[model samples]
Target: VAVSVSATASHPIPSTLWGQMFEDISSGDGGLYAELLQNRAFQQVTPNTTAALNAWHPVNGATLSVVADTVPVSSALPNSLQVVIPAGKTGPVGVGNEGYWGIKVTAGSTYTASFHYRFPTASAFKGSITVGLQTAIGHSLVSTPVPITAASTAWAQVNVTLRPTASASSTANNFTITLDGAAASGQTVHFALFSLFPPTFKNRPNGMRVDIATTLAEMGPSFFRLPGGNNLVSETVAQRWQWNATVGPLLSRPGRVGDWGYINTDGLGLMDYLNWCEDVGMEAIMAVWSGFALGGTSVAEASLGPYIQQAIDQINFVIGDPAKSSAAALRASLGHAAPFPLTYVEVGNEDFFASSTYTYRWHDFVTALQAEFPNIHFIATSNTFNPILSPNPLQYDVHVYQTPTWFAQNSFFYDGFERNATTYFEGEYAAISTNSSDIFGSPATGRLTFPTMQSSSGEAAFMTGLERNADIVFSASYAPLLNHVANSQWTPNLVSFDAGAVYPSTSYYVQKLFSLNRGDEYLPSTLPNPTGTLFWSVVRKTSTRQIIIKISNTVGTAAPVTFVLPFRTVASTGTAQVYLFPFTTVHDFDVWIPNRC
Candidate 1:
């Protein structure tokens, strides 16, 4: 492509255009979600050491029995595990928790372990309890003991600090708590709502995983679209992502069937996402549950009033007056007294498939949200019935998942969008390289396409078009920010990880480059006889007086290019920096590469 520059600024790009999307599918608490213990509340049934003991196992030849909570912590979670130690047979009797896959520990690092426990009747013996990080076979890595000298009928929480002298960076470890004493036959101690966490992102209680949060912050995203993809509304309306079901105490959160084919321990719920935004200094773009399920079922138009009202209540809960109602007060009780800074509340996700009912549902939600949040902006999904009635003018979500060829061909796709008709949010998009087809399902069968150099280059080219059309495009973000290699539900995620390590994909670098170098204004440049495969965009940062030029060579071979400056007089000693990505073939993707590599 031949390029020429002139002293003309065509359009000023919105600084908020480039951001990130975090869904809950592949990233549960065990993945990117910060809750350390998997099935901590024993809500998700798993085949393990005990019934309903998904990741927990009994230690020292003791049989741990799972039962309905005689002393319930909350109505949300009603199951608890009971450990029965006979009078003379056991060295130590308790449960070991397999956190996520395994609890990752660094040498000499401190972790917090806590759990709620109660004795059935008054225990005849005062058994001292020990809790720490350990291996599956009962090798303690970070052991600490806290004596339970007195038996209590009421449920009480015990806390302990553990510092491991050895490095279990393998992330293949567990949290074990054992009662090391003799007890009368059938004397039982019940355990409920156990948790073990490494150092958090901001050191807040019930906080986020530091590694995952740090990776996101480094991307310099301006906004975060939260509560996820198809997981926003599950296969059934009964299991949708509801803010009320996932707040306050961790034990109280009733886990649900994940839309992505597992269990969703809603440990990182509404407040967690909001607090993460505050921690990373990004704006919140909350996606509420629309009245439709992924199973091709939607609520009737007349029945949408309650869902709309719920949406309003959710907004109130986020930016509501705390003294106004009980729900608003509950938000304050969750530790965020001042209202969160929320501007965008998406009505439904991917309502385009709803066909005839989508328009009415969109209309119902827009009408209700506008009545309550007069100043707030609402984004319409791609399947909007009529964008003309939208509260936020022309704000419609545009999602694209395609191959490199498609991305290169559609460089001018958004240019033709009727300027005054509809504004756009490139909410979810990625280039699916044909080389690697690994996703979230069977290891033999691929899920989402893995990120490759070919794909990243294609995405970069597509982003150029997005930048060129910023006048109509309001904001854009990449989809499915995380994937756990062991149990992923989707692939080609921006970042991938296992129990031990987290790494960004080739596409992640492209996103980081564009986001970090975001400019203040778009400059008008021309490609005379532009080639089909080469894509480029030019912008100027008015504050720094620097012109940023981004170019993508999507073709297999390299092509020579030149830039002509718009300035009358150019600096002789000016510093110049160019970013060039190496060509990666489709077959080059390996999920286990280190993040920094």
Candidate 2:
């Protein structure tokens, strides 16, 4: 194949082309958030039963029960763990939390562990509580004694640092907070809001897991679409992701039952996401709750005024004057006096599910929000031109999930779109299955366990078309960014992880290559055949005087290709860099600079 690159540029490549979409599908509570313990606050959980004490277990035969306290530690957290020491107990007796699947203890790493405790009844017991990390079979890695000066009815907090001298052999470990049975046998103590955090991404309190955050940072993403996709919607309006409920001291934040069947601590809230954006050099693509639930429930038009006002307040909390809006004041109270930078505000997630009602919902929301914040661009999440949204939305978010072959065939998906004022955000797209008939089926029905070479190549080919038509396609991102390998609800995510390690799929590397090597200008080039197996796109970075050429060969066999630079002066001896990913091991790619092109 022969290719000729033009000297002149055609269009400017969008800076927001590559980004991340986050939701808590077992991804946040156990996967990304640095907090190790699961169900730490017992948020939204009923008292009693082993299920209420999801991760906690009795230690040294101590009786443990989840109890509802009249005078709870905080109103947001009504439930607490009550541990009763046996009358004749000899060793330490209390409770142990098997952190999300298991805790990963590293050598020389300092962990901050904290919990709120109070004696249910006034007692004279004055003894120290031992908090430490232990192996599954009862071997201690590190321990610290936090002395309880006086037993009081009112709750008191204890904070301690545990530095492990040696790492655990595996992730099958647990954290324990035990009391000396001899010091005060037959005493009952209540505990609430327990937290264990290893060093975070940037040492920010309640921050993200270092290893996972670092892996995402390496991709050099431009924006983060949060708090996440379908995770934004809920079975009911009350259970939806409320911006107000997610942005305060962890004690005040009333955690909710996440769309996924698990309790969300809300420890990683709105502020956490914005801070993450800043730490990783990315902007926020924030989404607001648009009075729609995943269970086919939409708030009536009359009731939408309050929800619309809620959206306005949500936006104000991000970029509003503190004196004018209470939400902004709350943001200022949380140490971010200056408002965070925000440009795109997605109206709702996947409104295509309820497009009939979206007509009025969109009208009511945009009519009010546009008046409040005219500078911000609102993205519509429904099928384009269907339902015919009033005021003619300036932007639309498109989503697609199909087989690898479908993605390759639909490379020119945006090429046919009318060149008008309205732009597009390919909010979510992925190669989920090999069988087109059962795209959303299980693994037995051709669903991908993880992104393979064929799927990644197909995605790459489609991305070339997105770059080719940069004028209409402003941004695009893969959906369901992360998944917990052990308890995943979705298949073939960009990144997969367990309690111990992270696994970046082939699709992840493809995204990284495109994002990290993005250029300022799209250089017109010789187009590939419409029905060909190979595709390419050319872009130029004006700052570095570098020309980037991306090529994708879908077939397994090697196919030779040559490029002829149309520049007046061609460098015959200068080094040319190449990043080669063969089909055999697509996950492992090689990069080297050759002596000549």
Candidate 3:
């Protein structure tokens, strides 16, 4: 580490340096995940019984049972829940679903609830159905009753408009559907494929959860790394995220078992993600499903052609000329006629885990996708193994998950590294605290994690390294961005929320502050001692002509330091507002409240 306090000059830094990562991992209702109904299509399976109904409970004298679909219907789910209101049953008897924990309903807002149903008999069943929101104890509010004069004997969809009263509580409400006058001695109605959604982000059908999307939009991310982390390539080859399986009609999408021990609705499909990016003013950094699976299974070279072509088609659908290719035409039919802009295409996620065959696999994908989509740049998983054999990648994805002390100590990890044509993307990195109560906190039962000062200080220190080497590190994003408190798969997420409120972690603020103040050019600065206790980066904004100095002090006591900008004249009025994040105890990292800082 060399330092010359006299030489304080500025150089160039890339503007595309910081962004966010969003994945489907126990994202709360009305949070990042859009699907309100947990087991919407009833695609549940367990050891005890095949069709396992997890989140749903019987309501008002109704008996719930999962039955296999005897007859196959076009694009219908395999299993359906049978609600039996006994012949002598009194009052409204039906089923209720506690959405992803609980349904979030706003006062005076209309929610669209729909379900598919069919009768056991061939005769047209005459009945009435009421769908609405209610407390867990059966106190009802805002019920929409629809008369079913004669529904089809085959699978038919029913939709109802529900508007909660102005006084209805927005939290801890459940979405329920009740059937009346349909309980006959020999008569029974079958129901399946239930769905309930609030007004989405842009009021688009099958859209994003509004509140979650707004949160990400506020962060002002440069790009959205869509579809997932290990989720892109699951443990099983059958469960890998297939773009084709996740598009178009909802019923047609056969949701696969997610890598994180749950089912993915794919309700937030590729088009939906692109629309979200459009709404948030970010580009798409799409990750294609490479032939490698996390379970250490790589598709043999002879049969890897289809997967490579799928990646090409995904690119074609996004950026290729619509008039020329069927893939692009399909994109047009999906309502995004004009191709969305995408600069980086990641071949696979964490493929370096299988380094034995990764280079060859990378070659296969790069050779096919790069030749066709010459305009788009490609990124590899990691450079841990062999240097990329052929068709060099533009950037390499690097991931680091370590303790806060490790991150703070390694703040200068990339200092004076060889400058090469290939840049770096820290796609998934976090100062994890798996053993601390701030993060793990009774890991056996706890599902949500909070960011502590120890963790955040480490993250800030590491980010200063990225800021210092912005020319080499083109972009970076924190991993597992949003976590639903009830059913999270990963810990130390950026944001955690239940049905009621959102808690942005300490690290979230660190990332937000960095993102909001990303300077255009790097400035050289010399420290007096250059100790590990302090980490900082100096850069200048090309647009504002502001000299920004981001400093992170990890030590216990603060030391007064003075700066001398020799090359430029200093003005007292040029000082901008100082943003300081004071340190707090690790135990107090539970959540963020207004004015807590």
In each prediction, how many residue pairs overlap at the backbone (N, C-alpha, C within less than 3 A)? 4, 0, 0
After superposition on all C-alphas, the RMSD of every candidate to the true structure, in Å, is 5.4, 2.1, 5.1
- Per-residue alpha-carbon lDDT of candidate 1 for residues 43-162, written as tens digits (9 for 90 to 100): 756423345777777676567767777777667777778787666765667778777777787887678878888886875567578787877666778787776743567888898878
Q: Tell me the lDDT of candidate 1.
A: 0.76
Model 2, range 1-597, lDDT digits (tens) per residue?
A: 988888899999989988888888878988889899988988887888778989888889999888988888888888888889989888888889999898999999999999999987886778899999999888999999998844579999999999999999999999999988888689888899999999999999999999899989999999999886888887888898989888888889879988888888888899898899999999999999888999889999999988998889999999999999999999999889898989999999999999999999999999999999989999999999888999789899899999988888877788789988889998899999999999999999999999888988889889998899888888889877888888888898999999999998889888888898898899988888757888889998899888888888876778887777776654444333333454432343333422233
Tens-digit lDDT track for model 3 on 1-597?
333223344456666687887767776223675768878876634412534767778776676777777743335367777776777766778888888877777777778889987775565556678887888778887798776643456777889888877544656677888877344323466777788877888887877777677777777788888777888889977789888877788777777788888888777778778877888888888999888888878898888988988888888888877799888898899888898989999989888777667777888889888889878888888564355556767688888877777778777767766676768888888877634345434445432256776777678888988887777888899987998887777887988888766777888777877887778888777742334767777777768767676667665667554455544444444443233456321221222112211
**Which candidate wins on lDDT?**
2
Q: Between the candidate structures 1 and 3, which one is better when assessed by lDDT?
A: 1
Ranking 2 against 3 by TM-score, winner: 2
lDDT of each: 0.76, 0.88, 0.74
- The order of the candidates by TM-score, greatest first, is 2, 1, 3
Model 3, which residues run further than 4 Å from truth? 1-11, 28-30, 44-51, 71-73, 167-170, 181-186, 385-388, 434-448, 527-531, 567-571, 574-597
